[model samples]
Target chain A: MLKLMQNEWMKLWHKKGTWIMVGILVILTAGMMGLMKWISLQNMGGEMTREGMIQDPSSLGGTVLLLTVIVAAGIVASEFSQGTIKMLLTRPVKRWKILVSKFLTVNLFGMFLMLIGYVVYLLLAMLLFKSDAGESLSSWSVWSKSLYMLLLSFGNVFITSTFAFAIGSVFRSSSLAIGLSLFIYFTGSTISALLSQYEIAKYLFFTHMDLTQFETGMMLVPDLTMPFSLAVLAVYIVVFLLISFSTFIKRDVTA
Target chain B: MKPVVELKNLSKTIRSKKIIDNLNLSLYPGQITGFLGPNGAGKTTTIRMMVGLMKQTEGDIVIEGVSLRDNFEEGLSKVGVIVENPEMYKFMSGYKNLLHFARMHKGVTKERIDDVVRQVGMQNRIHEKVGTYSLGMRQRLGLAQALLHRPKFLILDEPTNGLDPAGIREFRQYLRKIAETEGVSVFVSSHMLSEIELMCDRIAIIQNGKLIDIREMSEARESFYYIEATPAEKAKQLLTDGGFTVEPFTDGLLVNAEQHQIPDLVESFIAEGLQVFAVQPHRKTLEDEFLEMTGGGQIAEAYAK
Candidate 1:
């Protein structure tokens, strides 16, 4: 499985699009920070400090989700489009193992982007901006808060990409997967808000996708705890994976 | 010789329609077997089942003594496949593409990778991206990847689809060398009957999802010589008198004769004042035999019934 993941990673990095993704992540991270720096320079609203920006890295979520979804959508679908799926599946490795490795590699790519974005954010925050007068940027609470926020931001990326990966594999169309996943990501919260009064809202995956809502004190759905949300997301993720793996392992590779 | 791969009562039914029906075949080591069938005759379906890309609804594929049904990875590890065009990751360098495939099979070392690249004569542009490669170069890279693990059995579907004549000859020689030296079993499905005629030692023909015939290329076929002579009737009479079966051919008479008796017959024609314009050995091509077997690529009468 590790060897298979290595193969997936090698294929992933060899593409010019993947390198461009990383470059975009770094540039966007810098651009967002620069925008924040400029906003602080304008001083139109209340003071925005480096510690505060680091503590809430939700701004990275949209870019990360888009990038990760693009990759997850293509990782399996591109194999079909490129006609390499036959070459890939005809190997000694089992079908499920190949699917799992691709899944792992997609998430790994997402995490790598998240980490790089965070590091860039951290570097610029330290280099170009000052902390609030009484607070140190190196404070343990601030560091933990930023790291935790990064993890929560990644939760949305993880779930969205997995959704895209599942749809991509099952339907064998990258465009459909990317379109549907992004559609869900953009509209899930509003849909959940519309249905929050019903009991079915608690069971809906969209209600729990924004795990950061718990930290932001903005509850889209009332009386939902982190553990319950985690459990619901876990179930959704497992269902998505089950659909991906079963379809991948069983479908005839005519291509 | 024991068979390296066996398809036992294999069948595939998709959407209540039988694509391949109870197919049975065995491929021996050190022999190249050609698979020929018209389009949608289940050649690709059978090959897919053998390589585990498609599951057989019934029966088993045993490769190198391991049943694919029981141990897919173990069975496939000993097999190499190039189905249709060798679709590669055009985004990657040829060497990286090889490395990616090399990692899938166990015990394939970096040295083996380089060895395969050299064998395919891709040393100069091994590091170049596959997108820059021509179709011939991709085919070479495809073969290189398939041979990376030194498989015991190699399966090729239209293996020479895009190669030039020289490349095809070289590829044939390479296949023959591997089959001879390393004792590898090869199964190739191709539409190029003449190419198969030249490359394969034996052929297994399928029509309407049935194995119609399997024959050796080296097997002795009835030899006929086309004799184009002036006054064809006189030549026919002379050949019939010589106890040779004579059949009318275009502007000639086809006489079934042995090579040793050909000179004597020619002498008899000269002595009898028969002008023999052309005398050449006429052998049926694989295409002719294939068409005859498959009934001009139509649905067989048996199936139609």
Candidate 2:
């Protein structure tokens, strides 16, 4: 199993698509951080509290992590499209082992990129402006919020990567998977808002994906707790991974 | 000799269409068997079934005395396969691809990897990315991967699909050497009959998902030969008188004589005032036998009962 994992790790690094996705993640994360820092500096004359800025960092990390999901989805989806699955399957390894290897490698890559983005965002935020004039930028609350954001970022990327893997397995086309993933990412909140008047629409995976906001005490809805959202997100992750595994195991490599 | 791989009453169906009929074949160890067929003759499907890639609707594939369906892992462990086009991570170097494959086998060593790379004559370029390698090089790398595990049985589907003449010769020589030196049973499917004739010890011709015939090359070559000579009528009489079966052709008398006996027949014809224009040998190639056994006609007709 360790050898199989090693092989999968080698394959992940060797795939050009993975590196391209990483490059895109770095660029887009840096670009978003720069843009937000510029906007904040331009509005520096107004009152800016340290507490507000600490609260705002979660949203920033959340949004950047969301974009990272899209990038990671493309990386995972291209393997199916390029017919590399055939080569992987023909190896004398179990189907489940192969799936787990890929899942682990992809999440590891996502976590690495998330760390890079977080560091860049924090550096830019600290360099650009001072918070609340007299308050120190280094505090336990600020540190706690940053750690929480990183954990949430990890969970967000993990959930999204698994969902994209499922999409890739079922659709077996990178274009379709990327298109549908982006469609869901960009339109899910709007659709959920429109359907909020209904009773059962709140149970959707998209509705529970922003569970981190609840963790940072930014809940817009009553009675939705951090634990409840995490549990729901965890269940969705398991379901999606199971679906992906089943589809991948049964799929014939016609390509 | 015990057969290395055996398929008994094998059949496959996809979407209510029978892709492979009740096909039976046995390939013995230490022999190179060629799977000869035209396009869509279920050759690829049969190879897939043997390698556990596709499930057979109703059949049993015994690899090294183990059932493919019942003991898939053990059965698959004894076999190596290169089905369809060679698939690899094109971004990685060829050496990396082989190393990745080598890790899948239980006892393969790093030295084995270097040995296979050298055996395939790709040692110098093994470090280059697969995308930069030519199609022939990719094919060689695929073969190297298949042979890396030192499997007792090798199953290849159209292994010479895109090879040039020299490349084909090199591939045939390599296959012969492996089968001889390593004592591995090689079952290769190909449309190139001449190559099969030069390489295979025994061949099975398939058409429209059915096994038509399995015979040794020597036996297949003994069917008949076309012989041409001047004074066809006299030549026919002389051949008949010499205890040989002769059929008159437009320009010659086709003889059912052994390859060595042709010289005697030719000399006899010359002594009897019959000038020999030509005594060309026209034995049926594997292609000709395949066409004849498959009821030479449209592919759909070949499938018809």
Candidate 3:
């Protein structure tokens, strides 16, 4: 099983897209940082502060979600598209093990994107901040709150990415996976807002995905608790995995 | 003969249509066995079942005495295959593709990787990305990856699909060496008969999900002579009277007579006042025999004068 996992990692790393996607995200972060520098130069502001620079890319929750979903969606879908999965399956291992390794590679890539995003945020903030930047962002209370919000956002990103991975596995089309994942990611907050009037909104997986609301005390619906929201996310995770493995294991790869 | 792989009444049905029906075959070690069939003849389907890519509705593939149905991992561990084309991570170097496959099975070391690279004659370009490889090079790399574990059985489905004539010959030589040196049982399927005739020791001909016949090659192949003589009709009659299997050919008669009996045959023809113009070995290629077998065309008569 470990060997199979190792093989999956080898395949993932060998793909130029894996590195390219992360590079694209870093470039995007840099682009955003550049815009910040331009805004600071305009001198139409109170001194541009370090907190504001750090908050720029760090607040890119939707962008991170889109990129991560692409990573997660391409994991299993491209194998089918490229026909490499046939070679993968013919090896001396079970199909389930192969699927597990694919899932592992995708999840790890999601973590990688998060880490890379975090690093890019730090670098851009350090490099682009003005010499006369306002007060340093050193308040421990603000730091703790900021840390909680960022972790919550990243956690939600992982959850939605898994959802995309499942859809990709079922359809075996990366385009469809990316399309629907992005569609859902873009519309989830609006949908949640509309559904907030209904009591059953607390039960929707998308409603609870943005766990940052737990820290902000901004529940989508009345009487929604952190544990309850966590439970809903957990159920979604189980359902996503079940769909991924069941469809992957049972479908015949005729192509 | 020790069997490297055995399929007993194996079957696969997709969408209520039977793709394979009760396929039973035994592939022995140290020889190349050709799987011959026309298009959509269940040749690839059977191979897929053996490799566990497609589940068999009914039957077992026993590789080294392990049942594919009962223990797929163990059964598959003894087998390796390149289905259709050798699809690899095109973005990666050829060396990396082989290395990734090596990690799946135990005991395949760096030495073995280098050995296979050398075996396939891809040492110079092993470091290049697979996307840059020619079709033949990719085929060779595919074969190398299959042989990395020293599997007892190797299955190739339409392996020579896009190779040139020279490339095909080179690939055949590689398979032969693997069968002889590694003692691997090679099950290669193809629609080309001349190819199987040259490479395989025995050929299992399948048509419409059933084994048509198992024909042996070389010493086991049928040998005869094409006897062309004046008064061809009478020559055929005389030969038939002499207890020989004679069929009319466009030029003369095709006589299934042994080489030693040729002198007597010619003498009898001379005695009958017929001029013996041509007497030569009439070797029936696999294509010729298959045409006769499938009733697609007439034999001996089909060949031009």
- The candidate that wins on lDDT is 1
Query: What's the lDDT of the predicted structure labeled candidate 1?
Result: 0.92
Better of 1 and 3 by TM-score: 1
Runs of candidate 2 exceeding 4 Å displacement: A44-77, A131-139, A215-223, A226-235, B218-225, B229-250, B258-276, B297-305
Q: Compared with the true structure, what per-residue lDDT tens digits does model 1 show for residues B1-305?
A: 89999999999999999999999999999999999999889999999999889999999999978999999999999999999899988888999899899989999999999999999999999999999999999999999999999999999999999899999999999999999999999999999999999999999999778898999999999998889987888888888988999988788888889899999999999998988799999987888788878877755644777
Rank by TM-score (best first): 1, 3, 2
Model 1, span A150-173: residue lDDT tens:
899899999999999999999999
- What are the lDDT scores of the predictions, listed in order? 0.92, 0.74, 0.82
> Candidate 1's error at A69, in angstroms?
0.8
Docking class of 3: medium
Candidate 3 lDDT over residue span B175-272, tens digit each: 89889988989999987778888899988988778888986675655668998887877887888789989887777788888889988888878888
The segments of candidate 3 whose C-alpha lies over 4 angstroms from its true place after superposition are A1-3, A31-58, A123-140, A217-219, B218-222, B230-232, B297-305
What's the TM for model 1? Answer: 0.94
Supply candidate 3's per-residue lDDT for B153.
Answer: 93
The DockQ-derived docking category for candidate 1 is: high
TM-score winner among the candidates? 1
Per-residue lDDT value at B275 in model 1: 85
How much does each candidate deviate from the true structure in C-alpha RMSD? Answer: 2.6, 3.5, 4.0
What are the clashing pairs of model 2? none
**Deviation of model 1 at B152, angstroms:** 0.9
